[model samples]
Target: MPAKIPATVVTGFLGAGKTTLIRHMLQNAQGKKIALIINEFGDLGVDGDILKGCGIETCTEDDIVELSNGCICCTVADDFIPTMETLLAREDKPDHIVIETSGLALPQPLVRAFNWPGISTQVTVDGVVTVVDGRAAHDGQFAHNVAAVDAQRAQDENLDHETPLSELFEDQVACADMIVVNKTDLLSADEATTLTGQLKSDARDGVQVVKAAMGALPVDVLLGQGIGAETDMAARHEHHHHYHHDDEDDHDHHHHDHDHDDFESFVVGRGEIEDADAFTAQVAKVINDHGILRLKGFIAVAGKPMRLTLQAVGPRIDTYFDQPFGDTPRATKLVVIGEAGLDHAAISAALQA
Candidate 1:
């Protein structure tokens, strides 16, 4: 029998820089073949698209797999198990499998899925890497805006336990083999130290909490923990009971009442834009006005062949040219994520105007 492949599960909240961390890991994969199973929470596949356009040589088209139906944790039996089975059956198996889960995902269920019959023999849960947004932690937010997150939680009728946002954050941290506190550059020396200490205490004993900026940690530190997390189920129980399934067969019922119902996302389409900076500024205004949690998509800038990318967390919006539009349509489309009840027509008009 062949050795089981080591799979690393990268779990974090929205805007926590998990994609950036994974891109860095792929670039520094040291010539090893790595596969990515990117799980997206919204209507658009923004995270997978970003990684695909990243231009990292080690990461090829065949190496990237995306699951956009819903959160990987909720769809473990339906989506995750089959994906893993297909990957394991391939002739050219990846040396390492890295899963970048949706921001709202519960790592406990996804990690525990490795114990499934067929999958158990083929892959081992190498480690569960939970990334934290240092600046967000300093700002006292699980999602982007503190007040907005509070508003969303208050509106959730099905919210029986603690606030889902905070519990989700704790669940991610609670299930980690190692924690990467990213975006520390945005924090002051004293602020970074304070945040790190807080996270260290939250994490399990012996779990290393490292600070990073721009997700600049080495591949050695991120992967190869060899902890086999699937076997450590007792220690890594989920913080929120609504997420993790007691059995793989029971996941279908949970999916019907999934936690994602607390939030909503929609894609907004617009015509071509002339100015990238101006467009982003307008986006910033819209985000502030609408209290959007996340907004990321490609924009077709007028008179430019390259596609412009936009990602916003709170009021901070980053824009850049990621790839050429080529034959692809030169139109602007963005997926807007926020707590439920976003005014779609109003926001579209605001961006368009």
Candidate 2:
């Protein structure tokens, strides 16, 4: 029997640079044939589109698959298993497979899917890489204040104030084999060190916290760990373990209910913007005021023939012209993901203002 193909699972919170890291890997594949599976939470395929726009020869549109129906962790049997089988059945199989989970996904459940009889013999989990947003962590976006939360919990054993975002963030950290602290460029030296130390302390023993700026980690360092995470998941500590067990056959009913009510996503569309600078400023203000977690999509500027891509993690926003709009409709579209109470109508109105 041939050896199982090595697969890496990239898990992270919203706008934590998972797609950016994957793009870097694809660009620096060094002639190795690699397949990519991207799972996005919302309807828009922003991440997948961004990756395909890279124009890397090895990482073509044919080699990339996007799962936008739901979170891959919850839809493992329906979406994930079949996707893996398709890749494995290919005549010209890829050298490596990278699965980028939705930002809201829990890595452990996805890792457990590797144990499925169909795929167990064909693939081995290379490692689980969790990317952390350095700026967000430093700014206490995950929690109101890390120290205060800890102190409150310590003082009052019965007090449980873990928000959905904080719990999700910790679960991702707990399941990681390697935690990459990305967007370090936005952090001051002290802020970077502080955030890195916090992440290190939260991670499991022996888990390494790597500092990265702009998702620029050496390809060699990110891949081929041979961790076999499926077997080691028993040792990993996740907050939801008591509520859920590792049962490959059981469908994740709770996950669907949990995500829908807790996190809300909406699409904001508009005509071509005449002033890009003013529009971006307004978008930034909306994100900050509304506490938006992740915002990304393409914008149609007034004069520029190429479509402008906008991505934001918390308040930090980045924009660039990816490629020409081509025959596609020239309009502004963005997918906003945040907590349930987000004022969609107000945000839309502000963007137009």
User: What lDDT does the true structure give each of the candidates?
Assistant: 0.74, 0.73
Q: Estimate each model's TM-score.
A: 0.64, 0.62
Clashes of each: 0, 0
**Candidate 2 lDDT over residue span 1-353, tens digit each:** 99899999987655577777777778778888889998754455667777788788887788999876565666789988999999999998888999887435467888999999989999999889988878877786753244532432333222233545677688888888888887777878798878878887888765657777667665655776667899887877767631110101011112111113334778999999998888889998998788775678999999999999998755667889999999999999998876467898998887767
Best by TM-score: 1
Candidate 1 Cα errors over 4 Å, as ranges: 145-162, 244-353
- Each prediction's Cα RMSD? 17.7, 17.5
Off by over 4 Å in 2: 143-163, 241-353
lDDT of 1 by residue, 1-353 (tens): 98889999887765677777777677678898899998754355566666787677888988898876665676789988999889888998999999887445477878888999989998999888888888877787754454533443343333333545677788788888788887776888799889878987988875767777767675655666667899989998665555421100001111111133335778999889988888888898998888775688999988999989887644556778999988888999998876567899999899888
The alpha-carbon lDDT assigned to residue 4 of candidate 1 equals 88
Model 1 residue 206 CA deviation (Å) reads 0.8
